[model samples]
Target: MKFPRRRRDPVEVNLTPLIDVVFLLLIFFMVSTTFETRQALELELPESAAGTALEASPVTLVVTERGRYRLGERELGAAELGEALSAEADQARLHGLVVEADARAVHADVVRALDQAGALGVRQVRIATRETQATSTQAETP
Candidate 1:
């Protein structure tokens, strides 16, 4: 009599269903989640109702009450004024000049800055002034 052969079944686990389930969960979460934009610092810029739109300026000259000159926070003497502005104008090619002067600044000094800008071929020049109740009060007092 011939002996019957015993058969053994192969052992394996199907991972396609598990991968599909994970992918579906990811897609569901992505669709349901809302992303909020955040900023490091919330800034409120000053509003000027009657102010004209400002164009970019390369050189900013600050004149103190005592007639001291400053080039963007750096103190510049009257002698270096022309040379410095010229260098900036040359580098920028087309440049603008903005003058921010104290209320008590010397008129001659401010005019001198404008003259320098003109000499440097800078066509755009503007004077900056503060707009506030205190400024109006100060003007009324004296």
Candidate 2:
């Protein structure tokens, strides 16, 4: 003999509330999110809160101890430096020059680089300097 058939209740999950909550959260994050873009140089940058950010990329001129200017890897004389800097500034579309002079470099060499930038009509000339890092021994001694 077969037993009487029993009626089963169907189980259901309501997804409308869950979808609405998820959509609201996604919209909130999209509206409230902020983005920032920052570009940085690898060399040690001097600490200064008063410095102005250059609108154009800068050409770097490294002054050696022997009073020579190095643009990238090429060493140039004071006279040659001016021409090269002007050409680079034009080609690179840069409006600034950064003279990274070594501590032992001659004062005249640094001045000459500055003059070159000025002659090229580069208005944003800036000097890059790094804060002196105390040696481990020096720090320990104190």
Tens digits of per-residue lDDT for model 1 on 1-142? 9989888788789999999999999999999997642132122223334556576566667776666677754578788888778767864345667777766777898898888888878777777764433344445544
Q: Encode model 2's per-residue lDDT on 1-142: one tens digit a residue.
A: 9999899889899999999999999999999996431222123344554555554344678777777777855678877886788678774345456767776677887888887777777777667665555457754543
Ten residues in sequence with the least summed lDDT for candidate 2 = 36-45
lDDT of 1 at 90: 61
What clash pairs does model 1 have? none
Candidate of highest TM-score: 1
Each prediction's TM-score versus the true structure:
0.52, 0.51
Candidate 1, superposed: residue stretches over 4 Å from native: 1-56, 91-95, 132-142
lDDT of each: 0.70, 0.69
